[model samples]
Target: PRGLMSLKSFRDCAGEGMKAMMPANTILVLAWTISGVCRDLLQTPLFVKTMVADGGISGGLLPAIIFVVAGFLSFSTGTAWGTFGILIPIVVPVAQAVDPNLVLVCLSATLAGSVFGDHCSPISDTTILSSAGAGCAHLEHVSTQMLYACVVAASSTVGYVVSGLTHGSLLPGFASGLIFMVVTMLVLRQRNKQKDAAQA
Candidate 1:
């Protein structure tokens, strides 16, 4: 299937092909879905209130909080897809009605934030899934993935300000940023290797 590959394994040159040199290096993921209702039941009510807060004070800023809370929930639950599903639709309509112009940016910010949290989170399902599939440790996957995603996310935030509307574009806004990021990472890696070789 040629599923996901790890940046650490790529940079470290752990093995020449799909097979990992160290079999125990990988994490194993559980494929069956967790019950979403059970998850909601377990989440902190105080935190939920904060995300879906109403009125003048906490009201308008709720989207920002939704992003943050969803992040924590996703991280712990290990499934960003599930967490985001719960929050996005709830936040969208409200944000749109409040300020049409700011809605896109706000929404991107929220999505970006959710991704940011999930990428770094030890328990995030993507982290676990990637690690399990890549034959890498969960932490290894999280650390490397976090750096890669953060670079693109920061860049995407800028792009959001410039081109984040129905006034424009398509998907893999995720993938495009990832390409520039890989190039930048490679350049940085080459520089470090050179420095290390010279010092050696």
Candidate 2:
């Protein structure tokens, strides 16, 4: 009979929402802080040693390596922004030391990797919110998107590798990455068709 709730009910709902959100916010902050601190501590010394030893990492492979590391950090933290904060400092200085021209390429790879990892991570807020907004199950969305994300990640890894080798010349790398993605998609589509036919 009481279709509309009272103002007190609305206020109670709002209060509960705030209470639920507060802890989540706190945990995100803690996650960001810890990730940043640990990366800073390790990277500072690691970069120093890297610079002193063999003039740092090779430009051809460093971006790919940075991408992998950034991706891992983002995946584990479930926060791309936190991964960026943790990786930028290390990536920039190390990239500069390795090859000043490759800094942009390395930074781009780091950003791409962070985003890719966030999209793939089950715990990432963006992934959760996307599934919730789409009115679908979170695991279903994650499982469906994971394949596409991994394919893109593979293409990006190759692109970064080529860019690093080419002294930050991205055109060839971009073209190659695009070709790789297209070919991979076609192969996957064919495989899916075969699988469906077999099932039928």
Candidate 3:
């Protein structure tokens, strides 16, 4: 009797797996290279001095700024890990310089923003893998997920601002963000229902 698992079947399976992983591998390499360069630049004294001297980046808005910057970087690179590697070292010191009490808040903002961007980015490995796993169009998956990601990001931005203003208190900031997210989601659902009714 023939073996249940043929050599030809194994070869085909391996080939398909490698093909599915190629995009993620390529993105990882590119993201790591870019992060290395950014890490070097960010560590320079000139860059640190300039950043610390920037008066606008201080006070109760610093966490919001950091969150936005982290989000944009991760979204453009499509790699949350790379974003974290690039931003954490730089942002942590800067936050400490600006306000010692805000170190944890800024760190949390960076993490949250990077996650939000990775979730929404079309080229992110997680996004790509999710679409492939679901057997759906990649762009369709990104488009569908973008709305929800944006809603959460908006809420998080508000939370960051509140946290910064309140000197890093978690409770009030979290409560405000949760309220905003619930209200926004409800509004979106109501609008969708109205549109569906009108179409029907």
Q: Rate the local accuracy (lDDT) of all candidates.
A: 0.55, 0.82, 0.83
Measured over all alpha carbons after superposition, the RMSD of each candidate to the real structure, in angstroms, is 12.2, 4.6, 4.1
Q: How accurate is candidate 3 locally (lDDT)?
A: 0.83
| Cα displacement (Å) at residue 89, model 1 | 4.0
Predicted candidate 2 versus true structure: per-residue lDDT over 1-200, tens digit per residue: 37588888989999999997885677667756764675575557365437545776566888888889888878887888877766776677777776888889989988998998888999998899999999999999999999889999998888888888899997988987898999999999999999999999
TM-score of each: 0.46, 0.79, 0.78
Best TM-score goes to which candidate? 2
Question: What would the per-residue lDDT of candidate 3 be over residues 64-159, giving only the tens digit for each residue?
Answer: 888998899889989888788777767777777777888999999999989888888887889998999999999999999998889989999998
Model 3: colliding residue pairs: none
How much lDDT does candidate 1 score?
0.55
| Residue 159 lDDT, candidate 1, scale 0-100 | 45
Candidate order by lDDT, highest to lowest?
3, 2, 1
lDDT of model 2, residue 20 = 77
